[model samples]
Target chain A: MPVLYGSYRSRATRNLWLAGEIGLELELRQVWQAYRLDKPDAPDAPFNTRSRGFLSLSPMGAIPVLVDGDLVLAESLAINLYLARRYGGDLGPRDEAENALMTQWTLFAATAMEGPGLAIQNVHTYGRADSEAGRGEIADKVEALGRPLRVLEGHLGRDGHMVGGRFTVADINVAEILRYAQSHEPLLAEYPAVDGWLRACQARPAFRAMWDRRAAEPMWL
Target chain B: MPVLYGSYRSRATRNLWLAGEIGLELELRQVWQAYRLDKPDAPDAPFNTRSRGFLSLSPMGAIPVLVDGDLVLAESLAINLYLARRYGGDLGPRDEAENALMTQWTLFAATAMEGPGLAIQNVHTYGRADSEAGRGEIADKVEALGRPLRVLEGHLGRDGHMVGGRFTVADINVAEILRYAQSHEPLLAEYPAVDGWLRACQARPAFRAMWDRRAAEPMWL
Candidate 1:
């Protein structure tokens, strides 16, 4: 059995969605869920990100650690990629070429989309998106995001999926980043294709199930 | 022969270093190089990041595209991973678990280290590292960088390589990130292990070769 360690509050939500898509049951260990009620700051509590046991598992001690037998892996993208490759039925790439594309989209999601997406989220979450200074900063990020979004728009506008005209890990990876843009209502206005593609991708039953489950998680704060 | 589109000016350097490490010859497409000498404003040229052909290769028009047979990948990390896996010989992972670690560290490098490392570079390139606001910003980035750097330090302190107790694609992915910090002298001071590990990794003939080749490339503006 493979164990995924992280809270949905973190980037672990992406993996949870992936597990849903692949119909795989993961033994989830939520550090935050445990921390909410348990002795989070206690020296021996395994729920703490800084716990000795966690450190032994990963040098980063960051959640979304997956311990599959002898392999203890951290980082959500890696875990998702592993799960897709190892257990994904149609979700995994068919060959080395497809594998390269999968890696490309995954890295793009990680590097380009997620970074600006997080900034927009941060600005919105902090109530700064409405201010003049915040708007300026938001404009810059949006402008920076424009290039990638345009790419997505042009591609998704013509094609249905990210690769091979089907739902794969690439769709999950890229769409998840766009989902973060929901708070910024106007951000998606320019990228109609991306917006439409995101809706279609999220319309999948697996995504619905994951969202429901995520909504059901108890918030610590 | 596989075509790796992009110059050392882009993330392609990472893949070139891997090619050097594994003794693989890649068709290096120096688009930006030709831009400086040939037609700087060619509309259909593949050299232009915004050209129609380059956009056809990549939606985002980002560089370091790897065209291996039928596969066209745009991200540098993805290209490096594919190269290592497909043609790596001893440089690739040995098993499924090792593959997971390779993905993990590669994502870690792509997501964690590159962002701040680029910011640090921007500060240095603009000669802002010495200003008050610049110092404050530098302090913030360095502090934010502390977590991942410390993670690298603790792990490198114990293990010489990132995985399997030997050199693999994971080491190349990570060591490249730390190399950016070389410009920041005091940054590596606290993490003596990471410093030593980086020095040892960079001392490899392959890395030296890549650096020499990069030094020889013509800069365009």
Candidate 2:
């Protein structure tokens, strides 16, 4: 079994969700972000990004490093992609074209949507939406996100899913990023196709299982 | 031959460089970014990102859309990965683990480095570094970039290449992003491993061929 180091509350949720979809068992090791701890370097502190042992596994000190035999992979989307291709059956790409399409969507989610999506999600998650400044930031981020959401809406309208008209790693990767912004009901409501697609993605039993586990973890945000 | 849309100066350069390495002939179509035009939607405007035809190719209105047969792929890194797998010999991943490694590195480049790297590059390219404020911004971005560069330095030091001990699409993808920040000589000097590896990548004849063509294009920046 692959060893996954990071809390479910982190981006590691994406990996755990995908693993659930494929029924792949991962050795989940709990690692927290240093910011969450009062003394990250304390002798008795839990394994965190600042931990020397964790840094050896991932020099960047980010979360959700997957250690599979000799290969150590970081980045939630990349890990999910690798696991899907290596272990997933129908959940992975079926052909070279499907692989390329899956990759395109994953990259799109990372580069195009992740930044603004996360920002919008943060506004709600951190209870910043109550402040005027936070509302202004949310407005700007939502505007910035419109084009990508429109693109996604068009794609989903045409093909029904990210690729192969089936829920693959592409959907898992893309959905995880969009989930950050899913809290902004008004924003998501504008794009009905995207709204519908996201609902369907989250409705899966695997995603529910991952969400439940994540909810049980301590809420830092 | 795959049909590649975008100018040599755009992210398409990454794909073109890899194509040069493997001697793959791509049907190059020049589509400039909309911002370069005075009136992007003018009937007489060149086929730019705002052009209806180009938008049809890429809904995001971004450049460097690759059409290989029935597949329409966007995102430069994703396109390079696909082309490498489809046409590249040893330039592509040799196995499942190598594929995962390459994907991991590519995602790392996209998520971790591209934002600050491009910001620093723009500061230099747009001649903003002459101002005190621009210098401060550059310094901040350079600081933000150090950790990721250090991580990369460690990887390059260990493996000498991204995967399978050879030049692959991963090298091409990462080298191009770092190229944006390469103009800041002193910053790169801090990490000798990264600097040397980047130098070796650009030294390749294929990269040289691509660079020459890019240089011939109209300098917009």
Candidate 3:
């Protein structure tokens, strides 16, 4: 059985969404966010990703560390790609070209989408969600989002999936990042195709199951 | 022949370096930095990454856009990973476990090292390598670099490679990111193991060939 360290509230949601898509039974080791470092940590709160033990497993201290037998993977996106490839399902890319597409979109999500999207999410959820600072942050995130969204707008509808038609981990990987825009209605309004594609992806039963599970579980302390 | 757009001066160096290692014949379409949008046309000025043609192939207008057969890919790390896996020699990961390590380091390079290292590079090359701002940026990048370098200090040197006990594109993918620190003497000195690993990897003939090829070309305008 594979164990994924870090809570759903963290980027681990990316992997949870993949596990749902692949139907993998993952032992989720919920982890505290790094912000917890400022406050006193509970003696034994599930598992702190900041702890020495977890850091030993994942030196980056960022979470969704997946332990599959002998292999240990840290990055959430990397873990998803690995699971998709190892499980040998429809989740993985079909060929070299498709695999290239997979890498392309995954890196795009990481570099282009994830940073700004998370900034928006963090501002909205914890920081000033609608204050001047928050609005400024949202605007910056939205502006940062445009270049990549236009890129997606160009290539996305090539059979309603990112690569080789139909859904693959590429879809799940990229969609999860863009899903951050859902909370910012105006941002979503700007990119209709992105909005449509993200909606289509989120509507999938796998995504619904994962979202519902995330809603029910209090993974973050 | 796979054609890689964008020049060695851009992140395309990562992919070009990989091509050199894999012995893949990549038709190099040397591209210019996007910031050159302010400059006038030099009829035959190396194609700028920001050009409409490049963006049509890559929505983000970044490079190098790799064209192999029917597939096109952008994002430097992604292009390298795709090439490594597709043109499998020792360049790619050997098994499921090794694949996970490959993904881990690549993402680490992207998320952890690349941004700060590049920020430091920008400050050093363009901003102020010795100014207060330069010192601050260097401090920030060095601080940002500590975790990942510590991690590499732990995992690297399994018989002189990142994964599977030998040199792979994972080495090329990651070492290339860490290579940015070479210019910052003190930063490089702090992490001796990282410095050692980077030097060992850089000393390879493949890296030498790519570096030489890059030096001989006048891609920047």
Candidate 4:
């Protein structure tokens, strides 16, 4: 059985969606269900740097680790790629060219969009809005993020999906990152194509199921 | 023919190295051969992006972008993985478990190491020694980087290489990032295993060939 260890609201959502898309049997292990980062005595408390299981799986002490038999993988994007490739079908691309494009978009999401998108989350979720310095810094980052989002908007205008004509790991990874932007910026009014693309992605039954599961949870920093 | 457009010294080095590793037929296009970033007529001068070719592939502008026929890919790690998977050989681990570990380390190098490693580069290559504020900031970032370095040191201590017992894409990606750390900090002196691994990676004939080519080029950035 492939076991995914992480919280519902975490990057693990990408893995769960990928598993559903690939029809892989995945056991979702909610590592943070009991222990919030603020709490210490919960069963899920062993998710910090001091936790042996986390340290064993991820030296960086991050979340959303995939354990398939003896294969243990960290990094949500990489895990999605690995699962899609290994499963091999609609979840993966049909050929090399498509796969290359898939890799390109997935990485674009990770490197270009992740930094600014995470900043949006950090500022809105944690930063002091009253502090001029904090707000100014985050505002700058949010502004910088507009460039990448515009790029995505242009790409979506050309093609309905991120890579190929249909969905793949690229869609899963990029959509997951942009989900942050949708809630924070709601600049969806400017990019109709991108908005439509996001809605199409979210309309997937698997994604809807995942979102519903987390609907009751409090949004956290 | 797979034509790679960028200078050897830039992130294009990774693509060049990957081409060599996979034995791909590569034509290295020298876009800024006669001009430097500081030169008035340099193609990248107005925006001060890395390379014109890189900018052409990604409007936001970065290197190195890999072009194969109609398929163009950016992001060094993503390009390497695409090449490895498509070319069909063991530039990476063959075992499923080992391959996941390879991806794990590759992401670790990208997310954790690259930020501070690049900061160290900026300080060494661009910062003024007389600027106390600049030096203090660099010192703080460099110290913060020690935690990740310690993790790398521990990993190298236990395992001979990053992912598998032998070389892989993980090593290539990580070794390149660590190379930036080599000149700024006496990293080798602190971690013997990391030092040996890096030396081994650099000593590869393909790596040496690429290094020689880069060494002969004038500084652009």
Q: Scoring model 4 with DockQ, what do you get? A: 0.57
Error of 2 at A2 (Å): 1.8
Instruction: Name every residue pair that clashes in candidate 1.
Output: none
Q: Is the docking of candidate 4 incorrect, acceptable, medium or high quality?
A: medium
User: What share of the reference contacts is kept in model 1?
Assistant: 0.94
Candidate 1 lDDT tens digits, A72-135 = 8888878877888899877888888887788888888778778878888888878998899888
Better of 2 and 4 by lDDT: 2
| Candidate 1 lDDT over residue span B33-54, tens digit each | 3444456566644456766677
**In candidate 2, which residue ranges exceed 4 Å CA deviation?**
none
lDDT of 4 by residue, B7-61 (tens): 7767778878877777888887665533355573555453334445446666645
Model 3: DockQ vs. true structure:
0.75
TM-score of every model? 0.92, 0.97, 0.92, 0.87
State the DockQ of every prediction.
Answer: 0.84, 0.84, 0.75, 0.57
Candidate 3 structure quality by residue, lDDT tens digits, A58-135: 776788789888777888888888888877487797776777778778988888787888888878778588689899
lDDT of 1: 0.80
Model 4 error, position A98 (Å): 2.1
lDDT of 2: 0.90
Q: Calculate each model's fnat, 2 decimals.
A: 0.94, 0.89, 0.87, 0.62
Among all candidates shown, the one with the greatest lDDT: 2
All candidates' lDDT scores?
A: 0.80, 0.90, 0.78, 0.74
Better of 1 and 2 by TM-score: 2
lDDT of 4 at A170: 84
Q: What is candidate 1's DockQ? A: 0.84
